[model samples]
Target: MDYKYIEQLLERYWACETSLQEEQILRTFFQQQEVPEHLMAYKAIFDVQQEQAEATLGEEFDERILEMIEGDPVKAIPLRGGLRRRSFLRPLYQAAGLVALILTIGIAAQHSFDEEGQSQHTQFAQTDSLERPADEFVTVPETQEAAVTVEQDSINLTR
Candidate 1:
């Protein structure tokens, strides 16, 4: 048989125009008892291609990849160097502290308001008790005046 057709297919194969069937045809034709002298140069290339096409990556490949990875040095984290503490309850602690600070401020403000009102009321009562018109809304009650008079009498007695 003339090797003309095989030579044309090999030419197309090199030019990247041959179909898969044509490539298989060329591979089959080359494996004959004797290849044409000129085509002999490509025998080893085609035989290697055929062998590689039948090959698959297997457990040996996985083992080799793992061994290469395991051979590298492991990275270490420093105990006190740039690491921050992580806690699930840190937000709760912050919120509790914020609440305590706010409550303290609120209680302080309330106390200041109460003290101001009490001081104002005591000043008003002292002024009213000293002397006031009979028709005023806050004329001194007789009972409160009597208590003051009693305290003064006690002081006079002690003297």
Candidate 2:
């Protein structure tokens, strides 16, 4: 039999260029009992591929792999709806706290300004009382003393 096509496909497979169908053809051809002496050497390679294709893991494969890696079988914990509700309200709670902080600062600043204004008004009133003339002055019996007192009052008025 002419095996020129098989030889060509083997060349392509060695060069990593064979399509899936062509590779399957090679595997099937090698599976036959009587293979050409020249191609007999490659039959073992295709036989291994066939064996691997038919291989499967047992039903406990996943559990065994997990146990090997983690040393124990891990159970999945179900999450509560409360976690979702808390996540939804987290931003609202932060916003409320921020607003309260801003209001506190604003109130403190307003209170400080009001106190400063009141102090200024009190200082102005004290200065105004000091500048106002007294209701009574000391009466001098002597004319010379009265003249001295009048001159002193004139000097105080100028100040």
Candidate 3:
């Protein structure tokens, strides 16, 4: 019946000057069953907002959502000696740590084996460089005399 007042309030609302009470009055006026045809467009917006405001979920909603996400029932296990809550990611952290440890060990073992192989190659090269051919052997007269004297001393000791 008095659409003039509602129009004035809407103008103030669009200009960002309407108070909260005035906005509430506008909403309440739109909620009436017999809305004017000219104001029918705004009626839908307020009606949808009211419906959304009234929509609610039951107490089991969170449990159902958690079950759907985790594929199992979630339980709050209490800590034994601490007051703080433990995180659900603790197991994931442990698993990641185990994987990191295994990877580190594997990498270290691989590096160690590589170093051993390299050292063995180096040792072999050094030994090869130090080795002489059989033809390079030469006998000296002093060595022969020393050998004979050593043999004679051994014979004297046996006697």
Return the top candidate by lDDT.
2
**Candidate 3 per-residue C-alpha lDDT over 1-159 given as tens digits, one digit per residue, 9 for 90 to 100:** 678999999889889999999989988998999899988998898899899999899979988777677663244443453323234444544444444334333433443455554333333322332231111222123233333443444344346
Shift in Å, residue 32, candidate 1 = 3.2
**Candidate 1: which pairs clash?**
none
Q: What is the TM-score of each candidate against the true structure?
A: 0.35, 0.40, 0.39
**Sort order, TM-score high to low:** 2, 3, 1
lDDT of 2 by residue, 1-159 (tens): 999999999999999999999998998899998999999889988888888988898879988777666663223433376665665666655554444334333433443455654334333323332332221121112222323333444344346
Computed on alpha carbons, the lDDT of every model, listed in order, comes to 0.56, 0.58, 0.56
Model 3 is weakest, by summed lDDT over 10 consecutive residues, at: 132-141
lDDT comparing candidate 3 with the true structure: 0.56
154: Cα error in model 1, Å: 47
Shift of residue 8 alpha carbon in model 2, Å? 0.9
